[model samples]
Every structure is written in C-alpha cells, then in structure tokens.
Target chain A: MIFRIAWRNIWRNKIRSLVILLSVAIGLFAGIAVLALYKGMMNSRVRTVIYSETGHIQLHHKTFKNDYEARFVISNPEKLLQELRKNESVKQVATRTITQGMLATTTGSAGVQINGIDPAMENKVSGLLQKIRVGSGFEPGKKNQVLIGKKLADKMKLKPSSKLVLTFTDADGNIISAAFRVAAIYQSENTPMDERNVYVQQTELNPILNLGNGIHEIALILKQDTATHTVAKQLQQKYPDLLVEPWQNLSPETELMIDTVDITSYIIIGIILFALAFGIVNTMLMAILERTQEIGVMMALGMNRIRLFLLVFLETIFLTLIGTPIGLGIAWIVTSYYHRNGLNLESMGKEMMSNFGFSTLVYPEFPTEKLLGIMGIVLFTALASCIYPALKALRLRPIEALRK
Target chain B: MSTVIDAHNISKIYNKENIPVYAINNVHLHINQGEFTALVGPSGSGKTTLLNLIGGLDKPDEGKIEINGIDITAMSPNKLIDFRLRNIGFVFQSFNLIPVLTARENVEFIMQLQGINKTEREARIQTLFRQIGLEDKMDSRPSQLSGGQQQRVAVARALASKPQFVLADEPTANLDTASASNLLDIMALLNKEENITFIFSTHDARVIERARRVITLVDGRITSDTAKVDTHVQH
Candidate 1:
C-alpha cells in the first residue's frame, strides 16, 4: 500500500514528475556517451593495428624481435611456409624482407625503410589489397614494380607508374640499389607509418640479403580469439631460434594504454552517477518540504517513523525504475548503430583523434557486461541518494512539523 | 472505557535565534474516554500547540504526555509515531488529506498504517463512507469534493481508525455555514453514536454552541469552561 501511495504521489503532480525524470534521462545520456566514445576509440585502434601495421600474429627469428635489425631471416623459408600452410592454426603466412637505406630522385630523395614481399601473400597477411582504393593491388615477382605508402608518395609528388629508386642495405652494411615502378599508393592509418615504408618483390630483395632464399619475417593472419599460447609454443618448438608473437604481446603498450582508457571511462561514469545521485536528493528534499503538512498528519494518525522512511525510500526507487530505462534504451540504440556502421570520428575531428593514435573513424563497442554494470551503478547511486530523505521523513516530529 | 490523554505540565517553547517564545506554558489537562470537548482560543492562544502536545505530535518543553496510559513523551520517536497512528486522528483547518488519495482511501489511510487486514479495512471504510453520505464519492479526489465534503472525508479518516480521540484544529473553518453546521452535527452524532472522544481547538461559535463542553482560552490561559445546551443525537 505504501508503494502504491508513493507511485500515485508522482502522478499527483505530473509536471514535477516529468522534470525530475528529465534530469535522470539527461544524466544517463551523458554517461552513456562517455562510455560509447571511450569504447569506440579502443575499437578503432584495434582495427587500425590489425588492418595496417601487423596481422593477428607475426613470426620472427628469436633475436629479431629484440634487435629488430633484420637478424631473424628465415633460414629455410620454403620449409617454414610448407609447415605453416599445413596447419589450420596458421590462417595465412606472408614472407617479407626489410632493409633500410637512402633513396633519391630528380626532385629529392629521403632515407626510407624498404620491405620486399610477394603481393599475393602480402594481401592475405595484411589485407593491404583491400585498402587500395585508388589503384590496383601489388603484383608478385614484378621485377621493377613497388607499392609506396601514401605519405611517401605525397612527399615525392609521385603517382601510379611513377619511377622510384629503392636501395637495400645488407646486414654486412653493403648497399644495393634498384629502380622500381610505383604499382600503387598504400595509405597507412597512422601518419608516421604512412610517411615511411617502400615495398618491392621478395625476389628483388633475395640477392640484396645474399641469402639465396632468405626472408626476415612471416606476418601471420589468425582467427580472432585463437589459443595464442599453444600456437606460440608449437611454432617455437617446430622452428628453433624463431618466436611467434600474438597481437597482445606484439603491442603490449597499446593494450595497456587501452585498458587504462577503459578504467578512466568507468571513473567518469562514477562521477556522473554521483551528480545524478545529488539531483535525486534535491528532488526528494523538495518533495518532502512540499508535503510537510501531510507528513505531520500521517504522523499524528499513528504512522511510525519507519513507515514514513519506507515511503520516501520507495518513492525514489519507483521513480528511478521508471526513468532510468529510458536513457538506457537510447544509449543501446545509438551504440548498436555505431557498432554496425563504425563511426567516422576521423571525419568528425581528424586532428584531435589522430593526436592520440586514433583514426578519424570509430566504432561503438559496448559489451553486455559493461552496459549492465553501468546501469547497476546508476541504480545503486539513485537508491543511495534516497536514504537521507527517508531518514528525514522518519525523524520528523508531528509537533514540530505541524507547528507552522 | 479508559482515559485517552493525560498531559502533565506540558510546556512548548519556540526559539527564533536566541529569543524564546512560549507556545504552550506549563499546563496540565486530561481527556477521559469518549468525551467531546472543545478547546477554544484565539489564533495564537496555544490551543493548537496544546492539542498537538496531547496528540503526541509535539513534545512538551517541560512536561510529559501519556496516550492510553502510554507515556508517549518518554517513548522513542518510532514508538510515539506508532501510538499516534493507532490511537489518534487529526482533522486540520485546511482539511489536510493526501491529495493523491481518493476520499475512501484517505479515510482508509490510518487503517492502512495499522497494517490491518485489507478485507477488514475495506469494510470499515465502506461503512464510514455510508455514514458520511459519501458512498458515491469514495473514489473522488479531495479536490473533486466541496470544502464540506473534504472535511467530512477528513472526519471519516479520523473516525476510521476508531481512535479514542479525534483532534480537530478548526476543521470547519473553510466550510460554508450550512456545511459547517452539518459537519458539526455529524461529528456530534458520531460522538453520541460511537462514544468517540472529539476534541476541537476552534473559535467558531457554531461549534461552541453545539459542543458538549467548551474550554475557552485567552492569551494561552483557560478563561471559561462551559457546558452548552445539548442537541438531539442521530441514530
């Protein structure tokens, strides 16, 4: 009956109920937007790393990952390729040889890092072919053809079919030079990556390294959520002096940074929930003040302090139960839409997002648990806010309350 | 029947900053079982204050109050409210009904507070409405009813708990003369029929003329205690 009365009290003043409910809705909306943006930024980074920098995993000589100076060339490239193909765990493996040196043209030349790859294998490993919007994918074994990162191409004022010179430096510090055609211009998600990197055929690089059939690394594409620990163990045991790195290990700093962002978003949610709790407290205080006389009458009519306490507490709960769901629903819709379409944050504010290593485009990624936990906190804080009002109602003396 | 209220040297003082105002000076009063007495005084003669002290709504600055022999002034805040809910009912000058509650529900509120069985509460409220000539007005809100009707609803609410004493703080002040007389007669009739104690703090001559006993006050002091002519009681 007290519950029934509390519910009806809201209807007694429709305008007041609506006003309080609006505050709840706005508070919830702000919290939801913060969460969505945070998750979206994380998702965009994952996409960029997967689609551009590295495949899901990379295979390198044990010392190469540490030194990263081209010391991990595959000793028996064919055997490793055969073994990798036979195992379903390895989705795709593309071999690449990297050497850094200086290059020049009639206009200007700058120092750059050159990567030699089989175009077909490169497409399977890095999805580079899919991102080639303006030109065609790189061709395998082309003697003088190469793909230059868009940033490099822009600096050189070069276009498709433009002539470029690639120079490879061997581990012994021997420099070998070759002329190549610009097969395509590849765009990198990050400007730093885009401004560097020259790609050519593995055959073109084989002679430069002087290892007849040597390759520095094999970029491997694997299914999402695979058992990376087991796969790394197997690959390491099969090929001595070689190591396999999953996405998480390959980008530990990035992962840690993303986790930090997640925690920060939750902290933001806590602050918003506190603000929301205070709003409800203010509303409840006003409600009690308005009904002072009625409260006194109830007290004189033998209503115990506990009953009045329960009345105010129950009223806050009722309002929250009805109002919180509205904002949650809106958040769910907006997040779902962004998750599907993938937000274009780059389009919205490109410079700001890129400053944090984020692309202009973002996708809302809200997990069920994250959504549920945020809602629970909102609800708990709202209920907690009611305690003061309930206590006040209980502490009221019929005499002092009725005096005015 | 037993005495419903025993007030001892009840003094209520008000303070605005350091200045002190005595709302109820040291006074002692008693209301016996099923007695209808009026406490008549000017607006600030401390009549309402004294009534509140007796109703267990306010604590005396220097005295103790007992309702149904229970020392409510000495009781915890929780217990005092419980005693009020079970033992007293109030009708205020403004007909202080819960605006959200319908006429019948407002009357049923005290019983609801008792946590009484729903079937019994419904029956009691039904009977109350039938007596108050508001059987058709049960579901109507306080605003839907006339001033007299609203006060009658307040009257029904006070009586529904079947309390030993029902306190009225000028319950008829807002009603028309005819409505006031009718309300007074209904209250008087209830006093005779149920032997329920009805106490009023009022200046209305109509109520004083019909009250079984009138206790008049001037500037917080009892001036006249009179016995008025009795009117015929209704069945």
Candidate 2:
C-alpha cells in the first residue's frame, strides 16, 4: 500500500514529475553516450597498436631492445621460429633484423629504425603489405627493396623506386652502408611511427652486417588477441633465456591510454551524475515542501518514520528507474546505429587523429560489461539524493505540519 | 464505560526559550469509551492543542498523558507512533485525505499501517464507506471529490482502524453547513450504533449541540465543562 501510494504520489504534479524524469533520462543518455565514444576510441587505438604496429606477442634477446646492438641477437632463431609456427595458438610469426640507422635522400636525412624483414612472413604477422599506399611491395626476387613510411617519404622528397642510402654498424665493429630502392611508401594511422620506421628484405640486409641469420626480434600474431597473455606466459616459461612480452608490455603507452580512458570516462559520467543528483535533491525537496500538510497528516495517522522514509525513497527510485531504461534504450539505439555506421571525426581533422595514432572515423563501442556497475552507481546516487528530502519529511511535526 | 484517554495536568508551551506562550496549560481531562465529546473554545484557546496532546501527536512540556492505560508521554517516538496506530484515529479540518489516493485507498491506508490483512481491510472498507455515505465515491480521489465527500472519506479513514477513539481537530472547519451537518449526523450514528468514541476540537455550534459533553477553554485554561443528561442521537 505504501508502495502504491508512493507510486501514485509522483503523478500528483504531472509536469514537475515529468521534468525531473526527463532530466534524469537526458543526463544518463549523455553519460552513457560519452562512455561509449571513449570506449570506441580506446578500442580503435588498441586494435591499431596490436595489428598495425606490434603483434600480439614479441620475443627478443634479453638485452637486444636496450640498444639494438648488432651483437645482441636471438639464440637459435630458426628452431624457435619453427617451434612457434607449429603452435596452434600462433597465427603468424615473423623474425626481424632490427638496426637503428640513418636514411638519406639527395634532399634530406632522417634518423630511422630500419627493420630487416622477410616480405611474406612480415606481411602475415603485421599485415604491412595491405597498408601499401604506393608501389607494389617487394616484387618476387627483389633485393635491397625498402618500404619507407609516407611521412618519411614526403619529408625526404622521395617517392616509390627512389634510391635511398642506409648507414649502420656491422656485427664485427665496422661501418656498413648500403643503397636500397624504395619499394613502397606506406601510410599507417600513427604518423610518428610512419615517419620513424622503414622496412627492407632481411635476405639482402642480414649478410651485409655479417649477422649470419641471427634475428633481433621475433613477433607473433595470435588467432585471437585475448589469447595473448596465456600464449606469452607459456612461451616465456618455455624459453626462459629469451624475453617474451605481450603487446601491452611492449607498448606501455597504449596500455596506459586504455586505463586512462576508463578512468576518464568514469570521471565524466560521475560529474554528470553528480550534477543530476543536485537536480534530484532540489525536485524532491520541493515535492516534500509542497506535500508538507499531507506528510503531517500521514504522520498524524500513525505512518511510521521508517515507512515514510521508504515512501520517499521508493518515489525517487521509481522516478530514476523509469528514467534509466528510457535513457539506456535511447543510448543503445544511438550507439548501436553509430557503432554500425561509424561516427566520422572529419570535423576534428584527419591529421590530428593520425598524429595521435587514432583513426578519424570511430565506431562507438557500448560498454555492456559495465552496465551493471553504471546502474549501481545511478541507484546509489538516487538513494543519496533522496536522503535530505526524506529526512525533511521525517522531521515534520504532525501538529505543526498539519497547521501549514 | 472505561476511560480511553487520561491527560493529567498536561501543558504544552510554544517558544519556551523565547517569550513562552502556553498552548495548553495544565489541563486534566478524561474521556471514556463510547462517548462523543467536543472541545470548544475561541481561537488561541488551546482546544486543538489539547486534542493533539490526547492523540499523542504532540508532547506536553509539563505533565504526562496516558491513553488506554499507557503513558504515551514516556514512550519513545516510534513506540508512540505504533500506539497511535493501534489506539487512535485522526481527522483533520481540511479533510487531509492523501490526495494521491482514492477515497477507498485513503481509508485503507490507516488499516494498512495497523497491519490489517487485505481480506479484513476490504470488508471494513465497504462497511465504513457505507457508514459515511461515500460508497458511490469510493474510487474517486480526494481532489475529484467535493468538500463534503472528502470529509466523509476522512471520517471513514479515522474509523477504518477500529481505534479506541477518534480525535478530530476541527474536522468540519472547511465544510459548508450542509456538509458539516451531514458529517455530524454520520459521527452521531457511528457513536450510537458502533459505540466508537469521538473527541473533537471545534468552534461550530452544530458539533457542540450534538456532543454529549462539551469542554470549553479560554486562554489555554478550561473555563466550562458541561454534560447533557439525555445523550440522544440527534439528526
């Protein structure tokens, strides 16, 4: 009966109740939509980092990454690569002979990480071949063919089939220099990565450095990205002498960006809900004030304080509960539509997003896993917001209130 | 008849820390079961104050009030509220029916607080609505009902719990003469037929004329206590 009364009581002032309901609905929709956008942005960044830059897992010599010195090469590279290729979880593995050097054209020179890679294996591991924006990448039987980033190519005034000089140290402590024809100019979402990294055939570059088939890094993509941690841990245990790392460890910045997105989204939603809570408090307080005499009569008629509190509490809950579903439904519809069709950030500029390593077009990813937590937060806020109003109703003296 | 209300030298003072004004000044009174009593006085005469004290709606600053042999003044607020739920029913002058509820729901609300089951509550609701002559308006909300109809619903609500006594603080103050007379007739019928006690604080002559006992107050002190010999039900 109390529940019935409380439910009915909200409709007493139809416009006032509807206004609060709309406020809650709009607030929740804004909060959820922003969360979805952030989630989408984070997911896009993570996908790019995993598929375009780093594979799901990478194995390197213990000290190879520290300086990329010619001496610090992986032990038993062929046998490890063979074993990894046979593993069911490993989708593709590629070995790279990485060396920091300078790439120079007639116009300019830039510091770059020259990746010595097998055309087919590296293509399978990192999908680098699909990103080719210019000349056909690494034609059959081609030697000393290099793939330079579009940004780097543009900076040095070089194009496909242009000749570039690569200078680096040999394994035996000698200056080694080689001229490589640019095979293709690729464009990745990350402008800095695109500018700093270039690729060439391992067959041509390895022998010049006298590295003797020794590789500096072994990168592997998995069938499913979620299997990354388990596969990395297993590989680390199997090859304790080598250093195995997941993409998250290999790119801490991306991992940190994900965490920061989660925190930032929560903070954004929290601020919205915090503001809406004030509106709820104000509305409920006014409702209580308007019903002062009725509340007094209720108390006078022997309605217990707890029951009275519950009545007000239930009224607030019903208001929020009704509003939340409408908000969630609208959010789901909007986000689902956007998720499928994509929300283009063209107005924000493609170059700005590329610089930050994010695609200009994003599909909003609704955080379905966080729905329960979000609802709990909203319920807590509603409960907390109703406290003052409920307490005010409880504080009314029957005689004094009745006289009002 | 057994005494249902015993207020001994009870006094209620407002603004005691500032300029103290006694709302009810040390008034001792007793009301028995099956008695239709009226507290009559001018404005600021503490008639409603005394009714509130007896109903356990307010505490007396100076003295104790016992209702149904329990010292309500000494009880905790929660316990007093429960005691009031089981023992006393209230009817306000403005016909303070919960505006959101229909006439039947308004009456059922008090019974609900008393934990009366639905079967019994429904049965009593039908009886009370018929007794108050608002049977046809049972589903109507307070706002939809006329002044007379709403007041009848309030009266029905007061008796729904089958309390030891009904405390009405100017129950017909907002009603027209016809509504007031109709309401008084219902109360008199219920008093004579069901033997339900009624205590009213009012300035209306019709209530005073119908009440078997009238206690008049002036300046928060009782100036007259009169009882009629022939306590017959008046039309």
Candidate 3:
C-alpha cells in the first residue's frame, strides 16, 4: 500500500515528475554518446597502429631495436619462419631489413626509416599493398622497386617511377648508396608514419647491405589480436636470444592512450552522474516539501520514519528506472546508426585526427559490457541522490509538519 | 471501564528558545474508557497541544502521560510511535488525508503499517467505511470529495485500527453546518453502538452539545470540566 501510494504520489504533479525524468534521460544520453565517440576514436587509433605500423607481434635481434644498424640482424631466419608457420595462432609473418637512412632526390633530401620487406608476406601482415594511392603495388620480379608514402613523395617532389637514392651504412660499416624506383605511393591516416617510412624488396636491400639471407625484424599478425601476448610469451621462452613483444609493448604511447581514454571516459561519466544527482535531489526535496502535511499525517498515524524514508527512496528509484532505459535505447539507436554508416568528421577534424594517427571517419561502438556498466552507474546515482531528501523527510516532527 | 488516558501535571512549553510560554501548564486530566469527551476553548487555549500530548505526537515538557496504563512518556521514540499506532487514532482539522490515496486506502493505511493481512485490512476498512456512511466514497481521493466527506473518511480512518481511543483536533472546523451536524450524529451513534472512546477538541457548539463530557480551557488551564446526562444518549 505504501509502495502504491508512493508510486501514485509522483504523478500528482505530472509536469514536475516528467521534467526530472527528462533531465535524467537526456543527461544519460549525452554522457553515453560522448563515451561511445571517444571509445570509437581510441579503438580506431589502436587498430591503425597494429595493422599499419606494428603487427600484432614483432621479433627483432635483441640489439636491433636499440639501434637500427644493419649488422644487428636476426639469425637463422629460415628456421624461425618455418617454426612460426606451424603455429596455429600465427596468421601471417613478414620479415623486414630495417635501416635508418636518408632518401634523396635531385630537389631535396630527408631522413627516413627504409623497410626492406618481402612484398607478398608484408602485404599479408601490414596490408601495405592495399593503401596504394598513386601507383600499383610492387611487381613480382622487379628489382630495386620500392613503395614510398605519398607524403614523402610529395615532399621530395617524386612520384611513381621516380628514381631515388637511398644512402646508409652496410653491415661492414661502409657508406653505401643504392638506387631504387618507386613502384607505389601509399597514403595512410598517420601523417608522420607516411612521411618517415619507405619500403623496398628485402632481396634488393639485403644484398646492398652485404647481409645475405638476414633480416632485422619479423612481424606477425595473429588470428586474434588477444593471442599476441601468449604467442609472444611462447616465442620468448623458445628463443630467449630474440626480442619478442606485442603491439602494446612495441607502441607504449598507444597503450597509454588506451588507458587514458578509459580513465577520461569514466571521469566524464562521473561528472555527469554527479550533476544529475543534484538535480534529482532538488526535485525530491521539492516533492517532500510539497507533501509535508501528508507525511506528518502518515507519521502521526504510526508510519515510522524508516517507512517514510523508504517511500521517498522508492519514488526516486522508480524515476530512474523509467528514465534509464529510454536514455539507453536512444543512445543505442544513435550509436548503431553511426556505427554502421560511420560518423565522418572529415570536414571538421580530418586533418587534426590524421595528425594524431586516427582516421577521420569513426564507427561509434557501444559494447554490451559498457552498456550494462552505465545502467549500474545510473541506478547507483539515483540511490545516492535520494539520501538527502529521504533524511529530510525523516527529520520532520509530526506536530510541526502537520501544522505546516 | 479503566482509565484510558492519565495526563498527570503535564506541561508543554513553546518558544523556549526566546520566550518560555506554556501551552499546557501543569494540567492534570483523566478519562475512562468508552467516554465521549470534548476539549473546548477559545483560540490560544492549548486544546490542540493537550490533544497532541495525549496522542503521543508531542511530549510534555514536564510530567508524564499514560495511556491504557502504559507510561508513554517513559518509552523510547520508536516505542512511543508503535504505542501510538496501536493505542490511539487522530483526526486533524484540515482532514490531512494523503491526497494520493483513496478513502479506503486512507482507512487501510494504519492497519497496513501494523502489518495487518490484506483480508483483515479490507474487512475492517469496509466495516468502518460503512459505519461512517462512506461505503460509496471508498475509492474517491480526498481531492475528489467535499470537505465534509473528506472529514468523514478521516474519521473512518481514525477508527479503522479499532484503537482504544480516537483524538480529533478541530475535526469539524472546516465543515458546513449540515455536514458538521451529520458528522456529529455519526460519532454519537458510534459512541452509543460500540462503546468507543472519543476525545476531540472543537470550538463548534454542535459538537460540544453532543459530547457527554465538556472540558473547557482558557490560557492553558482547564477552566471547567462538566458532565451532562440523559439528553442525546438515544441519538
């Protein structure tokens, strides 16, 4: 009966109750939508880093990563490749002979990381061949053919079929210069990576470095990204001499970004929940004040303070329950629509996002776990907001309240 | 019948922070079971204060109030609330009904708080509603009824728990003459039919004339306590 009374009491002033309900619903919708946008942006950045720069896992000579010298090359590369091919978790593997060098044209020169990759295998791991913007990917038997970023080509005033000179130290510590023709110009979302990286056939650069059949790095993409750590740990235990790391370890900046995004999203949610709490408190207090005489009558009729408190508590919870699903449903529809078609911020933030290594088009993702977590947060917020008003109701003296 | 209420030298002081004004000044009073009593006085005469003290809604500043042989003043606040719920019923001048609840719900509310079962609560509320001539208005909210009808529902609510006594503070103050007379007739009939005790404070002459015992107060002191017999007993 008390519960029924409480339920009916909220509707006594329909406008007031609806105002509170709408505020809660809109607050939740805004918070959730913003969180989804940030989640999408951060997830996109991580995916780009893994698929373009660092594969799910990477292996290098223990000293190769510390200094990108051609001399520090992986040993017995054929044997390791064979072993990795038999592992079920390994989806694809590519080898690269890395050298920090300079690329020069008749007009200009710039510092670059030249990656000598096996075209076919590198395509499977990095999807490099697919991002070709200006020209076709490397021809199978072509010698001294290279892929350069569109940005680097533009900076050096070169294009497909342009001749460029790569200058670097060979394994014997001799200054060596090799000439290569650009087969393709790729454009990725990451501006800096595009400008600083150039790829050539490993067969071509390894011979110039006088490091026959040797490679500096082996990158692997797993069937599932989550298997990267397990595969990395296994590789480490088997080949203790090599450096084996997952994308998270190889790209600590992106890892930190993931953590930072999660923290900031929660902080945003906390702020929104706190703001909604104050609104709820104000509404509940108004309800209590308006029903002061009725509350006194109940108390005088032997309704205890605890029951009075429960009545208010139940009312607030009902309001939250009514509002939360509506908010979530609206957010779900909005996010789903964007997730399918993509939310394109190209006109507004394309350049900014690309500079930070994120794509301009984002697919907002509302994970089931996050949705459940937000529901829990709303309920807790409602319960917390009710405390002050419920206590205020309990503090009323029956005689004085009745007089009022 | 035993003494249902014993207010011994009870004094209630208001405005003790700046001015200590006595609302009920060491007034000792007693009433037996099944008595129809009226506490009447002019404004500021402490009739409501006396009723509040007796109902356990407020505690007296000095001296004790005992109801049905239990010293309610000595009980804890929680115990006093429980005691009031079982022992006394109250009707307010404004007919302070829970506006959201129907007339039947108002009558059922105290029994619900007492954890009464649904069947018994329905049965008791039905009987009381019938007794107050409000069986047809049981489903009506206080706002949907007239002032007199609301007051009758309030009376039925006060009697729903079958308490030892009912305390009404200016219950008919808002009613018209016909409604006030109709309400007093119901109360007098219930007093005769069920031997139920009723102690109400009123300035209405109609209610005062029907009360078997009239206690008038002036300036927080009972100026007169008179009993008249052989008149409206047949009503």
Candidate 4:
C-alpha cells in the first residue's frame, strides 16, 4: 500500500514530474555522449602512435638513443632478426641505420633525421608504403632513391624525382656527403613527424656512411597489441645487453594521455550529475511541501517515521529509474550512429588535431565496459539527493503539519 | 460504563520561552466507553487543543493523560505513534483522505498499517462501505467524490482499524447543511449499532445537538458539562 501511494503520488503534478524526468534524461545523455567522444579520440591517437609512429616494441643499442652516433651499433643483427622472426608473438621485424643530418636543396636547407630502411621490411613493419601521396614508393632496382615527407618537400620546394644532398658523420668520425633522388612524397597524420623525417634505402646509405652491415635499431610489430608488454618482457630477459622498450616507453606523452582519459571522463560526468542532483532536490522539496497536509494525516493515522521516509525515498528512486533508461537508450542510439558513420570534425578542428597527431574524422567508441560503473554513480547520486527531502518529511509534527 | 480516557490537570502552553500563553490550562476530564461526546466552544477556546492532546498527537505541558490505563503522555514519540495506530482513529475537518487513493484504498490503508491480512481487510472494507452507504463510490478518488461523500469515506477510514475510539476535530465544519445532517445521522447510527466510542470538537450547533454529552469551554477552561436524558427521543 505504501508503495502504491508513493508511486501514484509522483503523478499528482504531471508537469512537475515530467520536467524532472526530462532533466535527468537529458543530463545522462549528455554525459554519456561526451564520454564516448573522449574514448574514441584517445583510442585513435593510441592507434596512430603504435601503427604509424612507433612499432609495438623497439630494440636498440644501450647508448644509441642518447645520440645518433653511428658507432653505437647492435652486434650480430642477423642472428637476432632470425630469432625474432621465429617467435610466434612477433609479426614483423625491421632493422634501421639511423642518422641525424642536414638536407640541402637549391631552394632551402633544414635539419632532419634520415632513416636507412630496407624498402620491403620497413613497409611490412611500419605500413609506410600506404602513406604515399605524390609518387610511387621506390623505383625497382634503382640506387640513390629516397622517400621524403610532404611537409619536408613543401618546405624545401622539392618534388618527386628531385635531387638533394645529405651531409653527416661516418662511423670513423669523418664527414660524409651523398646525393639522392626523391622517389616519392608521403604524408602522415602527425605534422611534426612529417616535417622532420625522411627515408632512404639502407643498402645505399650504409655503404656511404662507411658502416658495413651495422644496425643501430631493431623495431618489431606484434601480432596483437595486448601482447606488447609480455613480448617486450620476454625479449628483454633473453637479451639483457640490449635496450628493449615497449611503445609506451618509446612515447611517454601518448601513454600519459591514455592514462588521464579515464579520470578526465569521470570528472566531466561528476560535474554534470552534481548539477542534476540539485535539481532533483529542489523538485522533491516542492513535492513534499505540496503534500504537507497529507503527510500529516498519514502520521496521525499511525504511519511511522521509517515508513514515511521510505515513501519519499521510493518516489525519488522511481523517478531516477524511469529517467535513466530513457537517457541510456537515447545515448546508445546516438553513439551507435556516430560510431558507425563517424563524426567529421575537419571543418572545426582539423589543424589542431593534426598538430597533436590525431585524425579529425572520429569514430566514437561507446563505453560498454563502464556502463555498470556509470549506473552505480547515478544510483549513489539519487540516494544522496533524497536524504534531505526525506528528512524534512520526517521532521513534521503531526499537529503542526495538520494545521498547515 | 467503564472509563476509557482519563486526563488530569493537563496544560499546553504556547511560546513558552518568551511569553507563555496557555492553550489548554489545568483541564481535567474523563470519558466512558460507548459514549458519543462533543467538546463545544467558541473561537480561542481549547476544544481543538484538548482533542489533540487526547488523540496523542500533542503532548501536554504540565500533566499526564491515560487512555485505557496506558500513560500516553509519558510514552516516547515512537511508542505513542504505535499506541495511536492500535488504539485510536482520527477524522479531520477537511475530509483529509489521501487524494491519490480511491475511497476503498483509503479505508484499507489503516488496516494495512496494522498488518491486517488481505481477506480481513477486504471484508472490513466491504462492511464499512456498506455502513457508510457509499458502496458504489468505492473506486472513486477523493477529488472525484462530493464533499459529503469524502467525509463519509473519512469516517469509514476512521472505523476500519476497529479502534477503541474515534477522535473527530470539526468533522462537519466544511459540509453544507444537508451534508452535515447526513453525516451526523451516519455517525449516530454507527455509534448505536457497533457500540463504538466517539469524541468530537466543534463549534457547529448541529453536531452539538446530536451528541449525547456536551462539554463547553471558554478561554482554555471548561465552563459547562451536560448530559441529556432524551438523546434517543430527540434523534
């Protein structure tokens, strides 16, 4: 009977109840939609970092990353490469002879990192072959062919088949210079990386630098991204002399961004629910005030304080339970639509996103795993919001309330 | 007749901290079982205050009240509420039926609070509705019913718990002349048929004329108490 009374009491003022219900539904929908957008953006950035910028795991000489000195080369590169290829976890592996040098053209000169890469192995490991925008990847059986980034080509006023000079120190500490023709111009999602990196065939560059069969870095992609940490740990234990690092260690900024996404999402939803709680409290207080006489009569007729409190508590719970599902349903439809069709932010934030190495066309990822936590937060908010109004109902003296 | 209510030198003071004014001052009274009594007085009299004190809705300031040998004034708030639930029923002046509930549900609410089973509650609801002559209006909400009908539902609710007594505070104050007389006839009939005790506080002469015993108050003190010999003949 108390349940029936509480349930029916909410509809006493239809407009007021519907207004509260709508407020709750709209607030939850906004919170969930924003959460999905943030999750999708972060997921995209993480994918770009792993697949395009750095492989899942990178093996380097202990001191090679400190400075790009050609003397710091890994010993027995072919033996380790063969072993990595046989490992079930490793999908693809590539060896790189890297150097930082100055590239000069007739129009301009700029400092850039030149990567010595085998065309076939590097293409499999980094997917660089897919990023070509202007010309074909490498000419078959051609010497002195290089792949330059679109940003670098634009800045140096160089085009496909253009000739450029690279000057750097050799392994014996002597100055070395070579000329190479640009085979293609490629563009990546990251602006700074595109502006700073250029690639050349390892066979041509290794001989020019007087470093025969020397490898400075060995990078490998894993069959599954979730196996990155395990494979890196196993490889590090086997090769204690080399520096084995995972993608997270290779790029700390991306790791930090991924770590903060959860906290940032929670804070955003917390602020929204806090504001909605105030609205709930106000609505419940008005309901109680309007029924002062009825509550008084109930108290007089032997309804205890606990029953009165439960009545008000149940009414608030019903309102939240009804409103939340509607909100979640709407959020699911909106997020699923955007997740499938993609939300294009090219006109609004293309430049900014690209600067941060993110794509403008975002596919929002719904937080399916976090739905339980979201509901727990909403229930707690409803419970906390009902306390004040229920206490007000409990404090009413039957004689005084009846008089009112 | 055995005494069911005993109030001794009870007082209720208002604004006790600054300037104390008495609402019920030094009032002593007794009521017996199966008696239809009325507390009649003008404005500013303590009729309503005395009714509230006897109904266990308010505590007296200076003295004690005992109903059926239980010291209600000495009981805790929770215990007093339980005692009221089991021992007394209430009817208000404005027909304070729960607006959201139908007439049948309002009558059944008290029995539910008392933990009565469905079979007993259904049976009592039928009998009470039949006695009040509103059998057809059982499913009607308080808003849908007329003023007289709502009052009759309130009366049925008061008696549904099978309480020792029913305390009615100005029960007919808002009713029209015809409705008031109709309600009086129902109350008188229920009193005689079931032998249920009834006490009312009112300024209405119609209610006072029908009551078997009349106690009048002025300035928070009793001025007169009278019992009529020909009450049945007058009805």
Which predicted model would earn the best DockQ?
A: 4
True contacts kept of 3: 0.82
Candidate 2: fraction of native contacts reproduced: 0.85
For model 2 chain A, where is the 10-residue window of minimal lDDT? A261-270
How does model 4 score by TM-score? Answer: 0.91
DockQ of each: 0.66, 0.80, 0.79, 0.81
- Any runs in candidate 2 off by more than 4 Å, and if so which? A140-142, B15-19, B230-235
Q: After superposition, how far is residue B166 of candidate 4 from its true place, in Å?
A: 1.4
Model 2's lDDT to the true fold?
A: 0.89
In model 4, which regions exceed 4 Å deviation? Answer: A104-110, A172-175, A209-211, B16-19, B229-235
The regions of model 3 sitting more than 4 angstroms off are: A106-108, A139-142, B16-19, B229-235
Q: Write down the lDDT of every candidate, Cα atoms only.
A: 0.78, 0.89, 0.89, 0.90
User: C-alpha displacement of A136 in model 4, angstroms?
Assistant: 2.6
What tens digits encode model 1's per-residue C-alpha lDDT throughout A225-268?
A: 45566777777777767877777787786789789987887788
Instruction: List model 2 lDDT by residue over B104-149, tens digit each.
Output: 9888889888888999999999999889987899999888999988
What's the i-RMS of each model? 1.4, 0.8, 0.8, 0.5
How accurately is candidate 1 docked according to DockQ? 0.66
Question: What lDDT is reached at residue B74 by model 3?
Answer: 86
lDDT of 4 by residue, B44-91 (tens): 899989999999999999999999988999998888888899999898
Question: For every candidate structure, what is the RMSD over all alpha carbons to the true structure, in angstroms?
Answer: 4.3, 2.7, 2.9, 3.3
Per-residue error for A384 in candidate 2, Å, reads 1.6
- Superior candidate under DockQ, 1 versus 2: 2
Candidate 4: how many backbone clashes? 0
